[model samples]
Target chain A: MKFCSVCSSEVKQRIPHGDNRLRFVCTTCETIHYENPKMVVGCLPEWQDKVLLCKRAIEPQYGKWTLPAGFMENAETTEQGALRETWEEAGARVEISHLFTLYNLPYISQVYLMFRAKLLDLNFSAGEESLEVRLFSEDEIPWDEIAFLTIEKTLRQYFEDRRKGHFEFHIGDVERRVK
Target chain B: MKFCSVCSSEVKQRIPHGDNRLRFVCTTCETIHYENPKMVVGCLPEWQDKVLLCKRAIEPQYGKWTLPAGFMENAETTEQGALRETWEEAGARVEISHLFTLYNLPYISQVYLMFRAKLLDLNFSAGEESLEVRLFSEDEIPWDEIAFLTIEKTLRQYFEDRRKGHFEFHIGDVERRVK
Candidate 1:
């Protein structure tokens, strides 16, 4: 936080009185702003017997496969964030099922929440954020080419649990980088 | 946000020169910070058919009853956030069932994503954030004295959905003051 939201003045990073943590206090209005890390929520959206996935059109992981997901909007819940991202990126309407996975990355200051969702319908087209939208059966997942380790991990866990008819939720930090 | 994360000097707000949106341009280092809202995810833990409740020991909702819930930590997902809150506030362990409710409260500058979880074990007490912890059957909920309307809404929905085994999901903005 470099500029004050209230006064539009330069912000200064300092240890506020009696507190030993970093805080951004506006130099002009003396307003202290707390920076909260953002969250990205989505689902392993599943159709009749297939799971929906998106190929990224944007950089960072352009052309790589991923689940439809993104950052939470200002006034949106995690489910809405997930569903909205699904619609935006893959044009798929989904019903969120169970809360499936929570990937927390404290080092990067981000959290990704994934759910097991059911596809409402099959109609889909690539949005501005996606290169393509496709459904993959359990045996068709491009495991090696999936976008992020987070998406890959969620998918792998989902498929394995789907077979055993037992769902064991897993939590891990994504440390994978796109080549 | 214009300025460096380390130096707090003016950078740039990624908008075009004539963008009407409220934006700041840093005159020093050229780094842009996009300020976004943070999400608070939590859960309402139920044990042996009894709903878990807590008495707030801190301000905001001090001295009132509530479900165990809090902000999503950078170290966990939304489900983990809910589970962590349940354990932290009620000293209870729960298996998160479903994404129960999604609340959008722009006025409060918060979006609370709550889940419905069944207690893995019934033994629980108030954690450091509460003065007390206990369980109440649906009929015994402290409706009028609940700390946050979000807590009350979550519990109410859980019971309502519990009927007919129709544990679907709903999204809406609830405006009720606990005071």
Candidate 2:
């Protein structure tokens, strides 16, 4: 941050009194702008033996397959945000069963929460941010073309649990890939 | 936010194209400032049959008892943040077992994740943000002076689970209290 959002004054990074971390402190107002990790919430919508995936029309991983997910908004529960993102990107509705996977990406400062949900019906289409939306069975999943590691890990654990005849909540950290 | 931190320009709230929510858009640089919910991570330190509680030395609930938790910072995992908070507030080290309770407070746009952790040792004292740090058995908890509903609910559930001899992960929403 270059300037204070409150006073419009230039900000400098420094550790304020009684704080150990460096924060953006305003020169005039002395307000500290703290930044925290953002949450990405979505749903793994299930239909019979298939799961929903969206072909992104956006950047970073355009045209790649991913579960319908996005940055969670304010004033909403994680379940609500997951449902909203699922509907917005896939134009599909689902009943959230429970939180299935949580992955913390410390490299990008993001926490991803993916819920297991039951698809209501097949009347689904791509939303603006998606070029296409479709269901993929375990063998039909585009494993190599998945957009993110978090999604890939979640999908892998999901199928593994499915094969075991039980579903359990999984949590782990996703370390940055060394290039 | 009244000003854009990017360019120090005045900002106005409006729905950006292809977006459904109102965001602060910079008048000069046209930067869209999006705000989202934050996560608060901490641990319920368990030693024998007692859990640890910290008396606040800060505002909002000064002097009220609460679990040692604070806002999750960048470049850290949830487990790491929880461990840090426990050490910072109670001067205690812990071995985190698993996530115990997840509470969504939509009114305040915060998610609280409390892990059930084992207190490593009793060489603990109050940290800077805590007036006092002490362990309390189920019957010795100060229910009336608890700082937040989320903490209270977690403690109550912890004891209930202790009685049941089986602890399960919990997830729920904390609605705004009606006064």
Number of the predicted model whose TM-score against the real structure is largest? 2
Fnat across every predicted model, in order: 0.30, 0.89
Model number with the top lDDT? 2
Candidate 1 chain A minimal-lDDT segment of 10 residues: A169-178
List model 2 lDDT by residue over B1-179, tens digit each.
99999999999999999999999999999999999999999999999999999999999889999999999999999999999999999999999999999999999999999999999999999999999999998899999999999999999999988899999999999987553
Tens-place lDDT per residue, model 1, A1-179, is 45675666788889887444578888888887776668778878887779999999888878899998887665555777788888888988889877677676665678777888988887888888898999999889888778788788888889889889887555566653555
| Candidate 2: residue B171 Cα off by (Å) | 0.7
Supply candidate 1's per-residue lDDT for A141: 86
lDDT by residue for model 1 over B1-179, one digit each (tens)?
Answer: 33455455545555634232334455555344455567677877767778788899888868889888887655455676778778888899889876777676755657677887888876888888899998898888888878777767777888888886788666667654535
As a whole number from 0 to 100, the lDDT of residue B77 in candidate 1 is: 58
Give DockQ for candidates 1 onward, in order.
0.24, 0.93
What fraction of the reference structure's interface contacts does model 1 contain? 0.30
